[model samples]
Target: MIGALLVMIWLLVAMLLLLRRSQAVEVVPSGSPDEAQIAHHLLLDASPTPLVLVSGTTVRTMNRASRLLFASDDRILPPPSSLFDESATHLRHAGRNWRADRVEVGDRSVVALIDIEAEERTAEARASAEMIQVLGHEMLNGLVPIVSLAECGVAAAEAREGDSALLGEILTTLARRAEGLRRFTEAYRELARLPPPLRLTVSIEEMIDDLARLFASRWPGVHLSIDVQPGLCGEIDRDQMNQAIWALLQNAAEAVEQGGVPSGRIDIRATAGDDVLIIEVADNGPGIPPDCAHTIFRPFYTSKAGGSGIGLSLARQVVQAHGGVLTLLEPFPTTFRAQLPGAAALYGTGSVF
Candidate 1:
């Protein structure tokens, strides 16, 4: 009787276990992976651009292209904000250029990287080639005539006395051409040897006042005005700042003149925040053409026939050297803005460079 009871109890336990297994199987919906999930994985794997998914600081998933484009190690990827927020930001990984954008996938973030190294390198190579070409053309333009005339002068001096007058003329012409070439070369040297700013407390109001007067005297046809807050000052190299501002004003005047507007208007506005000083040099003229905007700041690029194209480029270099930025603003009122950190702000941020 005891043996029979034990068998019945064992059978009851087995039946309970079988029922639980059946319930567990029923809990899971019977289907393949969700279509959306499959499509998402497919999109990431198939994209030629590098893609990586991240959660917090940890990279959760990366496409195959990420391995080929960037380092296999994930630590090199920049934070999502740097990649997504700044449109001008360029990323370098594995000696290649990459640009990234952020995408949302439920609660996670995805970073999509595009390799732009080829395009960037090509642009740099083209610009370098163009610089070489311009240098050759300019040098030959002066040298060829100078050499020919020198040879002619030598022959004339040896051959006859009658050509003395003509020889003198050739010599004078040679001197003039040589002087012009000297100036041209000097400008390039100056650009290359731009001295670091001598940080000194400078009065913005005084600077603008001086600049306004100078512009008014120089460009009689243009109406120049200044609007600067009183007691505004910044720590900058006074001389270099003056030069950069002068270049900006000169460019504005030239643009206005080109637009052929009688009595063209140029407005210089200065304002300072707790951390930065903002200066806007604006003119009422035809704004920069969209196509040439990218190249205008490049060295050796000029739309003006007599322009050396060094002025604006040199000015920008100076501003950059001072840990500031100069950029042309878009839309109407044709403006170029210069943003410089205040002396105290620079010290606070430890961005003195």
Candidate 2:
């Protein structure tokens, strides 16, 4: 919605500039062709959004912003259709998301590209600031007590007259708080330092089975089911993907356990379609709270007691590393989906289904 508004404002500005230029031409009557061309270029270049004028698939011209956007040694722009594929208003290129808007003008079209990724990053920075405040509060909650207890323990040791049991209790509490802080720091470190995926072809069914066994061992009371399309496979980092999927399963099992459902159940399904691998995990348990739907994936955010809150965040990071997305499907039996691209290459050749 914001991208559309920005595009509309820029287009209106361009049209108004053109209208004013036409009026100037009429008033002066002696404006040279070179002067008019320079004015046209200036009008397009003044806007920050990348704009490209194309005649069908051929690139007629583009401003400086567009040139920089589609930077190439030969200075040739890709076809507008290629950049903005049918039904795709969003394009991911050069590690950034662009909102593409194309407008037809006579025999040509003008494509406006807005950097929506910048807006997303701005919002994420805001959220991170808030998370940092919460983190500081949590750290201080643990640290203040630890410091006080350590001081008491030190005074007791120096005086040599303090009760032995009291000193032992103080030292024990200090060790526990320090261990908690260490684990807290370690979870954040894991979330921040996720390595690039080492892609390899693996049978989808086998992976799911392995995960099912692990889940069953961990949550014996929770019934787990797995369904994978026969002969389906994927080119992904096996260990990393397993960790990602296991986190999802763990979350579902924990939700079921917490909800105290009479018969807790988790169903995992995997399918390959349109060169993408889709994995969905659904659980029969209390669904996510409406308020938490937006922030569940944020690191260090959780409602559960003793929850480090890195499970979903780590899962998302792993999927993103494999050039995929992890999203929650709404309005039902609490489902999470992970879609990984390049599934066509991993189908049918290797059996073990």
Candidate 3:
């Protein structure tokens, strides 16, 4: 009788086990494999751009593409609020052509995307624009001199003096414009051939102080404030970082020139949290115009009547090289932020690098 009871108990246990397995499969998405089996399936599917399947703030699973794309996070992904809260989502959709959709899988939310293609297209467009800016710069230089020459000829005609050298004025104007064009072309070439950062360990705080002092001297009228915590540093290319931050600062000053004091504030803050360092340079100026947000980082695309739009693009490239990111705070009191790893971490291809 005891032996018979034992056999019955075993059968009941087996049935309960089967029921649990069935429930697990039903709740799992059809397209998603068990995350445990991800290692063996790496080659089966490929994503062309950086893709991350972020569930809340945690990355439940990442395909090969995501691993490569968000490598710097190394171990932990950023907070959900950082990527897709109301503010981020609005900025994403407001002025850009990119898509950011939320998908429900099981009882959780996942963000799926191929962001790199959009990035590449943006880069290519900027490159084309820089080429055009160079051309425009050259043409204006030539035309300016010609315009001056024409003015001189008119003046000479009115003077009716044999010494009124119309040819001389025209030649001088043309020559001056030609020289202007040459200088503009030289600047274009330097931007085009900008070298990849020679990265090393450096304290970002020191860099900020350097910027503060330099800008204070340059923009005597503008207040350049710095609030960086102690012992915060990153593995970066100093020259590139300087160039990136300078671009943002210069843009901020320009944006506030016509606006009132409410737009005059440019704040730079850095905090070291856990193993990461996040830096922000914020301005209260007339934030990026809706249309400008989409193309602001593109090369040669400038909204300023006298500006060349290559700064932000270079900034983005520098950030990307550091295995980091630089993004505009969309619904902001007008801010730009950069997220980079701390000095101890070195970037790797499939990891954070």
Candidate 4:
């Protein structure tokens, strides 16, 4: 009877000890609610897209990017206007609606504004407006060409001289000029038709290798260096992402191709965090000009001479379409970083994206 009582007493003491340890646990284990929060810390810090958490009118949290975007938080917030705006500040855009509002949250300005359905809509409108202005430019490029040639051809025909030479020269020049227009229009089609990307579970390492191989093959003169993490891949479109990386590589190659810098170094890196992943491409070439830095991704903006200026913009579009982000960090040697959410978080968590 005493032994039995002692066993019961030991069991009771062990139960109390376990209860105390349970209370001391900081976060739930894997598959628990708190586990997800801990896993997403890096994403919360470095995500390129802005995120604002609100509970009825009280601002709960704003990430680093949201803070930088708003400029200042003290500015008054516009009243709620539309579901997209969620604010009442409606500035008449004449053709479209535009609004801006600011709120303060922990030393940051979170400006909540209208969420547009498409960037292509804006790009197409801008491209069309540019074409209207460039019509004269195109005419000038071609119109001056054939008059002299045609007149010479007629003179040759009257003199019983061979008209073939004059006619061929004029025809060749016209054909070349026409081909230029066709190529330009083709580029426009590529920009305007920014096709919907296919999303898949991609290992980040594989993309890095593929991009590296592509650049290595194309730019054999420039040295390519990749420091991507082997297992740190995420969900992204393989073809479009390959194209984006190719654009970045070309941009970097341009910066260094000239005779200024000794040996150009193109560094491609991928770092994966709990819930976020960042792929960075940095070049030791001449950094982007300060004047053109901010507008680099804007359509029709390019620092290069005779460059069509849509590559970076298209890259940005692709990243945005994947619910990811691409940004330029310009100081000395410029760094272009692409930030994307891990497939697991974006797919599993409701708040991800």
Candidate 5:
């Protein structure tokens, strides 16, 4: 998208240059508009970026993109001053963020609106990928040698004669811990290397039933319930979506266990809209701490002792890969919601952390 935008900008610049050259060499008839002017208008209408031409505060003309943006009536545009601040580069309009750029064209001012929200998300995802690569590289370098040495020590201790029991036991513990660390590192690496999901039409009710059964087997003490709309189905990566939902369920179960709730309960609900699917998991446990809320979704950020801290982050990544959003809703009962696009609305959405 950015590359296409850059190409459009270059084309606009070339058109402006041609217009200047035409004005310098030729003159059109007094009552008729020049060929350059006609071509310039055509280019403006063809541009993907919303372009508006205004004489002071009054909007003189706008392109198709601008008309769609502001929902203009019969090609009539709203006053520029009302839509955006002339001095501000960033503005929120029509429920989206935009980077506004103004250019002077003779007496009229041309305002170009560039949607920056998607660009910002792309930048954030890039930063996360870089961070994961660097951390994984550094940690694995140190962990691999430690794991190998621990295994060698364990073997050596077991082979030694007389009073080797204590040494062997200590070496075995070290080897186990080191191996666990290696597995943890590999899990995170897999998260960083997650591939695009393979989508399928899945039954929401059956999926919820599976999750409920799994949760019951894992935490028999905690009660689990499901409330899915009948015939609720969506086009999604079934395995990825299941993993994401399981993470939420496991997180809730752990929270309930940690809080020592006498009567723990978890509810999984699924509802469908015209072009979206909403899945929510709520638990009656000691909710997330106020201070930890911001960093909870961050990879490897955990408050629990010996926690892998990969569940929530992995769940979020999977949902995002499926062109969806996984969010922790605020307040009590500790609900996590995943909003996903249905088949009709599945195009153009990209994955992000």
Candidate 6:
């Protein structure tokens, strides 16, 4: 009887311990990371494209980019369906146009946002090419007859022994207009044919100083200041980069004049980054109108009367061909920023730092 009781008591203790272990296993704290969940989180966080997992309308979780984009505390966002239809539509968020898509991840849906800037650029390039072809066709056909007619008028007046002054004036005016149109079309064509940058090591500081002095001489009354980080340099096409900077400076100066600001100020600044060199041109002028912001980079879109509208477009094209980007910084309404890859980054030699 004593052995039996001892064995029974031991068995009872074992059962109790087993029961406690099972209960402990079942009671996982809410939201505790499992192997798969942790992996998904890491992948989403590392992805360049912004992503968010939504459980119905409430955002179950999101990566860093999502927080930066929404800028709101509410995790429960309006359904993606509201913003996007069956087809991927553009949503202007955070000052960029993004095409959002709904994707299924397990039972939940994830919203994937892709930036369409490159696509826009491709489209713009195609449109510019088409326009150039049309312009060339139209201008050639139109100018030939005008030139021929003007020549014939001048000849007739001279042969008839009549006063040739009127014909002379008409010929001169026609020639001037034709030349101006030719130059205008040529500018657009140049943007299309912007040569691949011939890269060479150049001091960015020198470029800044030179541009400032040149512009100051051109606009004697306007004040131009340069702030360049010492010992900063980049590998770039010298003449092309000079042209780009000159265009930016000229636009800023013109903006100041148009705004009619009493004390016009234009500031040029340069700084070196780990993998890129940044140059900024800012002016105290009436900034680009918000309404025209979308079309500002489009070829032949101009705000100024008599403006060819190709200056900014060409400047941007030149920068892009060099594997850099030129953008209008909205934070400073009249600021244009250019980011170009550093020499090390361009050549793949070593870290830019």
Question: What lDDT does the true structure give each of the candidates?
Answer: 0.78, 0.83, 0.67, 0.68, 0.79, 0.77
Choose the strongest candidate by TM-score: 2
Whole-model lDDT, candidate 3? 0.67
Quick one: best lDDT, which candidate? Answer: 2
Whole-model lDDT for model 1 versus the true structure? 0.78
lDDT of 5 by residue, 15-62 (tens): 999999988996567656676788887987899998777665576447
Which digits, one per residue and each the tens of the lDDT, describe model 1 over residues 1-353? 99999999999999999999988883435454676677887887777777776666566337767766545645435443444443544566666767767777776667777768766788779977977887888889989999998998888788855667888998999899899899879987888799888887777777788888888889988988888876677888888989999999998899899988777999998888876888889999888888888887877578886888887888898888889999988635679899998733222333222
Clashing pairs in 5: none
TM-score of each: 0.69, 0.73, 0.56, 0.59, 0.61, 0.59
lDDT for predicted candidate 6 compared with the true structure: 0.77
Clashing pairs in 4: 79-87, 79-88, 80-87, 80-88, 81-87, 81-88, 204-233
Q: How many backbone clashes does every candidate have?
A: 0, 0, 8, 7, 0, 0
* Cα lDDT of model 3 by residue, 1-353, tens digit: 99999999999999999999988886666556686467445643365543445554465444555455455433335533444452343223223333445566775555555354577798779777766876777577567767877777667666755465665766676677667667666766766787877876777677888898888887677777788876566767888888988998887777766555552777898876666668888877667777678777766667776776667777877787777888887625678888877554233322221
In model 3, pairs of residues that clash are 71-351, 71-352, 72-352, 126-299, 141-177, 145-173, 347-353, 348-353
Model 4 Cα RMSD, 1 decimal: 22.1
Candidate 4 residue 59 Cα shift, in angstroms, is 12
lDDT of 6 by residue, 76-164 (tens): 35544534343555676667788877887676767777888857899879986867775776577658877786887767677877667
Candidate 6: residue 186 Cα off by (Å): 2.8
| CA shift of 257, model 5, Å | 1.0
- Cα displacement (Å) at residue 124, model 2: 6.2
Instruction: For model 2, give the 10-residue run with minimal summed lDDT.
Output: 72-81
Q: Among all windows of ten consecutive residues in candidate 6, which has the lowest summed lDDT?
A: 344-353
